[model samples]
Target: MRETNLDNGVLILSEKIPGVRSAAIGIWIRQGAAHETNADTGASHLLEHMVFKGTRTRSALEIADSLETLGGSLDAYTSREHTSYQARVLDEHIPVALDVLSDLVLSPSLRDSDLSLEREVVLEEIAQVEDTPDDLVFEIHSERLWNGHPYGRSILGTKLSVEGMKGERLRELHSESYVGENLVIAAAGNVEHEEFVDCVASYMDTVVPGVRSEQVAEPSNALAGLELVDRKTAQTHIVFGAEAPPHSSEDRYALILISSVLGGGMSSRLFQKVREDLGLCYSVFTFQSFYRSAGMVGVYIATRPATATRASEAVRGELERIAEQGLSDVDLDRIKQQVKGQVMLSLESTGARLHRLASFALHDEPFQGLDDVLSGIDAVTCEDTLRVAAQYYDPGRHLELRLGPS
Candidate 1:
């Protein structure tokens, strides 16, 4: 892998895979929902959609066909911390991929007519989430857990906010973001580092240098408690979550191990005890999220209303056991191997490597080859899990969220 930061501040990263004929590349802007003000709540996300509407040189229909004609694909998405525009194509089409990606970032035509049409599409997206109990459960939990912090805001802004958005604000957001310092261009596949860098320079040399708006100050108003939302649904959706260490913390490895032991797979304790032993729910899993200043870990479960209380209690029991006893040496070693396997297996695809490369750069993490990552996982000891579990996993510290028919 080779990394370069152009004079304009756009960081370009590329890796060559010897045996593959395909490549994955993307332009990542370090701006998203958290970067927005209340007045322009969904500008970042809305802009993500509008970029595909058209660019100065290409019509919407032409943009759609640009890569598809090459048998490749173009896509983009917005998250809480960042937005990405990406493409996957054969190595020979690398220039086409770069051209389309750079164009979307540099020259979006955010016309009022386009905004009007796309805003409704975004509203429909918001509605879909509200209607899905499981997805809605987490949205409610994040807003409640983080309270008034910017991180708590939904990626899909409310109807009122989206409707109020103007094309002017979106244009300002595009100019404010999508600049050199806030951008990271990355690619992985059968390509040479120098040649890929040259391709990127051709398209992105005109991009201006801009400042990065990273917030390192931790949230002081984080909340935790039981909150219930009444919704008419067949199955109760529950989300139990607690504050966690940020991305830079060494404790992150320990937390991952704890999550895996509890609910990472069918062989996990939650699956064996909750589903197999008690037959409480059809699905149960633990997930982890890390940000620059704040992070969270959660357990999601969907069960019939009659059995909701039992499932909640069962989950709580597992949390208690983990917090108190931590993990045995055998359990720790097994989970470590499990996590290592997952990390090693995912790198076989160019697309996965593309994301890994981009994420490490965005977060200011030093690049870790497979050995470094495997070693990090291997170095975690049983005692380390005990410390993190006790510090972050007190059942009382969690927000107990429930949504379903009453």
Candidate 2:
């Protein structure tokens, strides 16, 4: 892996891999939904859509066709801390991918007509989330978990906020956050670092090195109470969790091991106890959402409304036991192997490597080699898992959100 800084303040990271025929390139911006104000909640996501609508030189169809002709793919997504636009193509087409991606990121048209149409599209997306109970329940849980903070708000924004968005509003937000200093260009697989750097520098050199936005501090508010939304659905979707550490926390590896032990796989305690042994539900799992300053670790379950209470109790019991007794050396060793395998498998993909490069660059984190990561996972002892669980997995700190029939 190599890192370079363009004169314009754009950070470029690349990984050169031999014996591969394809490459993945991406432009990662440090701004995302967390950067929005209450009045413009979904602006980051809306801008992600508007960028592809048109640019100065290419219409939406042209942008789509340009990549399709090369037999490559183009896509983008918005997350809490950042937004990414990436492309995957054969090694020989790396230059084409870089050109198109830079154009979309640096020169979007954001036309009024395009914004109008895309607004409806985004509104429908918001509607789709409303109609999906499982998705909606998680969003509600996040809102309750991070109340009074930007992280609490939905990425899609509310109907009123999306409706009130205008072309100028998006332009203003873009101008403030999408500057050279906040951008990182990353590529991996079947490419030379210097050549890829030159290709990106040609287009990104003109980007003005404007002031980047400030980072969001961790939320200080206490977790709010349980939130129940009546949806009249056949199954109740519940997300129960408590606050955890940030992405950069030393305890992150430990939390990952604990999450997996709790609900990561069929052999996990939640699945084994709730579904296999008790026949409680069809789906039960644990997850973690990590941010720059803070994070959340939780369990998600969808069960028959009649069995929701029992399922919740079962989940609670498992968590309490872990907090008190911690995991056995056997369970710890098993989860470590599971995590190590998952990490090794993910590193085999160029796209995943591209993402990792960009993420490390954006977060200013040093890259950890595969062996190092595996060793870190291996070093986590049973006592460490128990310590994190006891510190961050307290039931009193947990917030629960439920959506189902009245």
Number of backbone collisions per candidate, in order? 0, 0
The residue ranges of model 1 lying beyond 4 angstroms of the native Cα positions read none
Residue-wise C-alpha lDDT for candidate 1, range 1-406, written one tens digit per residue: 8998889999999989889999999999999888887767778899999999999999999989999999999989998889999999999999988988888999989999999999999999999998888899998898889878888888888889999999998998889888998999999999788999999999888888978767645878777778888999999999999989888888899999999999999999999999999999999999999988778987999999999999999999999999999999999989998999999889999999999999888788899888988888888888888888987876778998999988
| Regions more than 4 Å wrong, model 2 | none
Q: Write the per-residue lDDT of candidate 2 for residues 1-406, one digit (tens) a residue.
A: 8989987789988898788999999998888888888888999999999999989999999999988898999999999889999999999999999989999998899999998899999999999999988898988888878877888878988999999999999998788878998998999999998998889989988899987667878889848446678888999998897878888888999999999999999989999999999999999999998788788899999999899889988988988888887789988888888888999899899998888777766667898777878888888888898899998775666887888975
Question: What TM-score fits each model?
Answer: 0.98, 0.98
- The residue pairs found clashing in candidate 1 are none
lDDT of each: 0.90, 0.88
Lowest-sum lDDT 10-residue window in model 1: 213-222
- Model 2 Cα shift for residue 179 (angstroms): 1.0
lDDT of 1 at 3: 94
